[model samples]
Each structure stands twice: as C-alpha cells, then as structure tokens.
Target: MAASKTKKQVRKSQFKLTSEQEADLRKVFDIFSKGGEESGYGTISAEDIKIAFRALGYEPKQEEIRQLISGVDKDGKGLLDFNDYLAIMTKKMTQKDDVEDLQKAFELLDRDRDGKINSGDLQSVAAELGYFTGTMAEDLQEMIDFADKDGDGVVSEREFLKFLKKTTFE
Candidate 1:
C-alpha cells in the first residue's frame, strides 16, 4: 500500500510584530535593498515607502503614506516589522466608500449587542453579504465551525477580525 502525502499549508498573516518592531524590520529590509550600506545610510523617505508599498501591491494615497511615515525614526535608527506595518497596511486609507462599507460590515458582525464580534456573527454577516450558500441556519453553523478557533462554542471578536485579515489573500 502506498502512503498518501499531504502538503503542509503555509498560513499568511498581516503582521506578527508590534509597531516599533515593524520599524526595525523595515530598517533591515531597506538596508538589504540598498546593498547593505552601513556608512552614511540614507533614510527611507516617504517616497521610498510609497514606492515600496506599490511594489507590495498596495497603492495608498499620499496622505496615507505621510501618516505611515509620520512617526518613523526618520534617521533609519528605528525599523518597521511586519506587525507594525500591518496596522497601517490593512486600513482603507484612500477610499472613503470602502471605509464606509467596512464599517457597515463591522456593525453587522457585532451581534448579541456586544461591542465585539465572534464567528457566529461572522456567519450571519457573511450570509447577509451573500458570501455563502444554502440559506439554512445549519449551513451557517457549519461554516462557523470551520473558522472557530476555540471549541468553547463561539469565535471571539479577535478571531473573527483575524479571519477577515487573513481571508484577504484568498
């Protein structure tokens, strides 16, 4: 009998570090991109960040770029890790309509009158948003089951938010 092989799945995340750590990551990234120049290293300017973001497939507006660089250690002493960059990266900075729709989605997901949303809320919201099938409540439950992290019977707000953040790649 031949054994069946399964490929390991690589999970993609928006960030895994703090805002300050993101700066550090950015410094290392920039230096590597600049041929590892150590002496009189040039700062990663707003323009540079903008161009980099574009390369990363995100074309944020000038104001958004300015905001992202506002507190950067302009001397390149501080760096931006993946996590730090995530806060600014996923934001709907340039498009007002997109922000409004995102807000609406947030509102719908926050079920049970709680300020936060869980996986159940996600199922309902997804259904309302027409992202699923079979109009049955059981169907929604099954979808929620797939995304719920804690077996405690509900997906926490943070988990739902994480699911949203991760689903971007799909």
Candidate 2:
C-alpha cells in the first residue's frame, strides 16, 4: 500500500516582506517559542502575545491584541502560528496603503466585525482602548454627532474614513 502524502498549505498574504524583515521576524519568533520543537511551527497563544507586547513596552489593549491576531491568523484557528506572525510583521513593517491602514483601524473600532460602528461599538472601543471618560451615553452621542455624517445612527466605512481623514488633516 502506498502512503498518501499531504502538502503543507501556505496562505497568501496581501503584503510581502524583505529578506531582512523575514530574518528579524524569525529572530523574534525564536525568542517567543524557545521551548517548542525545532520544526519551526511554534505557536503563541493570544495571552502570550499580550505578555510579549508588554515586555516590548507596548500597553496594548485587549481589542488591539484581538485585532492583531484576527487580522493575521490566516487559518482562523484563534492562535498565531509561525506564518501568521510573519504576516503580522509584514503588515507592520510595510504599511504604505492608507486605505488598508484605515480599514485596519475600522476593524479594531468595529469590535463585532459588522461593517459599521454604532454608539455601542464606539463605547466598547473607547473602553477597550482605555480612553473612556464622562458618561458613556454622553460620549457615544458626541461621537455619533461628530462622525455619523449620514445621520444614519451608525458610522459606515466611508464615514469612518472621512472622519479619520478630517481629524488627521485638521
């Protein structure tokens, strides 16, 4: 009987990394996955990611960590494997697309991946990012009044992008 062989799947990513970036990422991954087997498929849990980020002097919020993991976890397995780490490093090191960056910010703010942001979403994001102040209702209303340009009670991607651009340019 012949043995059946399965090919390892390689996920396609939007951005590519330079050789130097790849080498640097490999080095970082080694630090995170020291006790793992030598096959290079070492994985890091989401919690471990938060610890690593903190160790590197980043005060990352939970939503930020979730966004980072979900954005790069190609297989959607909830844990970041080696390839997923590489995808994240590539995006971080080569983020030249304004729209892509905006979309990433939108995704982080959306929280629920609903393609829109409402008062609740804004409140949730504010709380997660540790920026909440004043009454929740008041903050939500203020944010909506400022960014809900279409007056639809929710901020669509277009409105979100416009809001960001306006704030950035102002």
lDDT of each: 0.53, 0.69
Q: What is the C-alpha lDDT profile of model 2 across 50-161, one tens digit per residue?
A: 6665543446678867887888776776678777766655544443345567889898888788899888888787788897776777868788778888788889999998
Model 1 regions more than 4 Å off: 1-104, 115-135
TM-score of 1: 0.34
Using lDDT as the measure, which candidate wins? 2
Q: What is the per-residue lDDT of model 1 for residues 22-84, given as tens digits with 9 covering 90 to 100?
A: 565465446434432455243343446666666555667788666665555355544444334
Cα deviation in Å at residue 37, candidate 2?
3.7
By summed lDDT, the worst window of 10 consecutive residues in model 1 runs over 6-15
Predicted candidate 2, C-alpha RMSD = 15.1
Global Cα lDDT for candidate 2: 0.69
Clashes per model (N, Cα, C within 3 A): 9, 0
